[model samples]
Target: MLMKPLIIGQLKARLPIIQGGMGVGISRCNLAGAVALEGGIGVISTAQIGYDEEEFSRNPIEANLRAIKKHLQRAKEIAKGGIVGVNIMVATKQYAEYVKAAVEAKADVIISGAGLPINLPELVKGSVSKIAPIVSSLKATSIILKMWDRKYNTTADFLVIEGPLAGGHLGFHEDELVDIDMDAYQEEIKKIISLKKEYEEKYNQEIPVIVAGGIFDKEDVKRALLNGADGIQVGTRFVTTKECDASDAYKQAYINCKKEDIRIIKSPVGMPGRAIWNPFLEKLTKGRSEIKHCFGCLEHCNPKEVPYCITKALTNAVEGKLEEGLIFCGDNADRLKEITTVKQVMEELTV
Candidate 1:
């Protein structure tokens, strides 16, 4: 077995693996805490963190901020001594507030994506939490590194390269996502590595780069390492785990899904998202359903102009309302065969 501890500056994990953050209440305290307890870094997604709170639909900010501490405290209790991190999307409506809450909750690491986290260092200042940005290309990495360096006099503690094949909202446009060659992405990876090396030379710091999106099994892990990734982030595989916070129906959907059933759908949040084709999606595509509410979660979303409310759809899924909820999954979700525990899944991936 290839077991190399991933060193993200001062933070270290027994396994060079990160449990990719799943949102809309999917990977919560239980899932993240279990992964950390099992030796890998467990990441809680900040996307709709206040998902189950009673006032989430009314006061998303207060609810989400409160949920951050709740989730972090629960994760810490389960972690015992392991690492726990949180993923907050930059495109979120309350990005700064959520990031500050994560820091205040004493999270070990904070991963931001969906846009360049130019102000991450500022949000995390005076805190011990490490900051990382998920980028899909070197251009994005360069832009972030320059901004962080110039503005905050800080370098990234770590970096994540999210490829087009990964689930949920993608960094690339829909057409580019399907049309780009994987071979071309390899160059982007190399450029990011080179950029990391440049910073290493200038600042005399070592920054670890992790790759995510569409990663499955040990074979995928090996491929990522070979491609210069310090570690790997796996998400969809964990959805079917016993410790996963998602509903049983959600897990079963992955197991029962075929490759063709996984398709890209327009998020009311103004981004293209990958999800399992379900009754909810069918209704949205056919314009048979009307969005009853909007949470103003994403900055670009307008309930009046969009097809449906993303917050409502995701919340429904989280609460087990399968027929009316949108279920997000990665490209490899169709390969899931059975549900397992978090420990079992970690062992399989680490091996």
Candidate 2:
């Protein structure tokens, strides 16, 4: 099948693909720009984006806020006018401030998830930046649409269905992930597409639905489009790309792992996440993972009680300290064979 153009709000991409945002210095300017330059929408993850800043340890919030615009600008520059966006998780603290910062920076789009993002439309009010809410089920979709329509008089510019196989913080509970696969989600996608038709007619606008999590290679893309999705969001497959901001050691982790290495663990951010099993996760099982200092990244995190500092673990992985930090990844991470370029990955998927 030929690849279709992905239109979110007024933005258009020649390819029906959005590279899923990987946080903690994973998908930043380099990767996002490269993908966008390739005709797919490129996305930068704003989670702990300032980990490399000089003053990040002292005041992470301010550091992160300062970095948001910086990264977006750099990514846009690299895109050379392609569609570039940022992924801001609703679970992040100072969520409103982050949204405002992205809008102020003239981001092409802002994709939010890890929570309902009920107030996303309100936050992006009057801005040209398109908004996409990430959801795993119809229930969450209904809540976001109802709240946004009733309160803000707007609907999502696009929707991302992050299935059970997604990495990092998942929308579904741990129990729900048990024995579920992509086939189980086809009917739900049909329902969501059906539900979205109402708002499309009411608002008289098209709201593209993108599928994320477990999407890899050309076959997956064909399957998603055939299943009624407008596009697909892929993360794990991009980890080993040269353009990805992750360190070489971090990228190697994706290539070295086997299927059994992948596991879902209870993340400190009050959600379940998929990650590669490593010494770091094993340490968590044997004893308490250290929380040296709070980054104040999440809205509800208590430094005293969180299993570990997510910021630190991710930072460690990004900096090549694989054994010292968590390696958050999708289930397909094990399938990675060698490091490649962003252009090559895009070609393989779209072809």
Candidate 3:
């Protein structure tokens, strides 16, 4: 059967896929625009988006704000009226400012996670940009719905359920990540769907639920739809696509890895993340690596404490300095066998 289109509020994508926003310059305008052009929702990650800006190190905030507009413009140019969105983590230092930037840039949607986005409606107030929150558990989903309903008198345009197998920052605990039961996790997704129905009835709006994490192939997409998700969000699979913004070496890391190479590591933001084990991470495991600079990217980061600079490590990875970088990926990153184009990947997923 052919895949169905995803409808979130007034926005509709010809494909039921939303590319997860990978950060540190991994999924910029290049990959996002390409996906949007193919009738899928393209999402630009706002995390450390200005890393390549000339004044990034000195004026990170201003640089990011400016780049948000620049990159979105480029994505729009490639999209040709297709749906383009931005992903802004709630844990960022200037979370509200980033939301404002995305809205001002005229993003069709704003997907937020890395923390509960209780105040998301307020930030996007009066804007046409739809807001979606990524969640891991039914409790988090319930909390967000209640808060948004009671405080803002609004509901999410859609919801993204990211399981523990996802890359980058996870909403689950370290212990939960290690021994995740697929059946139990699917049950959680269904519970969230049931909870969302209450709000849908109250607000008289459709709340499409998109499932993510470990959704590697067409079968995964079928399973998600059968399990009550209206769509699926994919991250690792996109990294191997030609349109990905990351360098060749970065894509090679995914192509070259075995299933055993994937491991869970501690993120500086006090969350457990799934990434490929590399020499840089191995060195940090033996001892704390020195912090070279503070990018002021995260709300919980302190220059004086924590592990190595996450921004720097991720930047190194995207730049293809594998030995000195942190390569974030989903549990199936190692399953990627070769580089492919975004159009081909989309075709395979929809097939």
Candidate 4:
């Protein structure tokens, strides 16, 4: 069957693919713009977006807010008219400001995850940019929809169901990650679709449901489409692309990774995250080094008590300090063979 265009608000993406947002400089303006140019919805991750700016370590929120417009402008220049969106984590210290920055930058859409974005509608009020909340289950989707409807009299432009196989900060607990079966998620997807239909009927609008996590090739996209998904969000595959903002060493890590290398590690932000097993991770597992001061980014984070500072580790990795940095990747990172351009990768997956 032929794939159809993905509609999010008034924007129509030629390919039903939303490039999953990676943070700490992975999916920056260059990568996102390339994906949009390739006919997909290119997403720029807003996690510590100003890490490259001077003094970001001292004031992350203010730095990131300033960087949002700069990145979006660069992405728009590269896209030349294609759809470009921003993926902001709800757990960030300045979530509201970042969302507003994206809106001000004329971002086509805003995809939020890592927590329930209950006030996302309110944050983007009066903006043309559509809002999408990423969820791990039907219950989360239901709760978000109901809250948005009741509080703001608004509905989501789209929904993203991110499964356990996704990289970075997971919504599920460490134990639940291993225990929950993929088959069970199917029912959850069905329930979310049903809930979406209810809201669509009430609001007289269509809410597109996109499935994410562990999606690799065309076969994976096909499975999602067959299972009631209007599109798919892919992350790890995009990491190996030429346009990705991550260092060459980081992409090489994905290319060289083995199946056993991908494992869940305890993040300093009090959440379980998936990453490639590297020398740094091995050292972390052995508890060899003492963690330095925390950056105080996440609300639940306790730097003095947690394992290590996630922002520092991730920023280090993105800066090419592979030996002492945390390298986040999806379970399918092991399957990647070589580096390719974003245009080539999208063509392979969509065609």
| lDDT sort, best first | 3, 2, 4, 1
Q: Is candidate 2 or candidate 3 better by TM-score?
A: 3
User: In candidate 2, what are the lDDT values of residues 1-351, reduced to their tens digit?
Assistant: 567899776788999889998989999999999999999999999999999999999999889988999999999999999999899999899999999999998889999998879888888888889998998888889988989899988898999998988888898878887778666678888889999999999999999999998887788888888888899999988899999999999999999999999999999888989999999899888877767888899998998888889999999999999989899999788889999999999999994
Runs in model 4 deviating more than 4 A are: 288-293
C-alpha local distance difference test of each model? 0.88, 0.90, 0.93, 0.89
- Which model is ahead, 1 or 4, in terms of lDDT? 4
The list of candidate 1 runs beyond 4 A from truth reads none
Q: Write the per-residue lDDT of candidate 1 for residues 104-186, one digit (tens) a residue.
A: 99999999998889998999999989989999988899999999889988899999898988888888888876675888887
Query: Relative to the unseen true structure, what is the C-alpha lDDT of residue 208 in candidate 3, on a scale of 0 to 100?
Result: 93
Which regions in candidate 2 have their CA more than 4 angstroms from the true location?
Answer: none
Expressed as tens digits, the lDDT of each residue in 55-128 for candidate 4 is 78787788888888999999989998999999998888877888999999999999999899999998888988
Per-residue accuracy of model 3 over 1-351 as CA lDDT, tens digit each: 647788887888999899999999998999999999999999999999999999999989889999999999999999998899999999999999999999999999999999999999999999989999999999999999999999999899999999988999899888998888989999999899999999999999999999999999989888889887899999999999999999999999999988888999889989999999989999997877888879999998887888799999999999999999999999999889999999998998994
TM-score of each: 0.97, 0.98, 0.99, 0.97
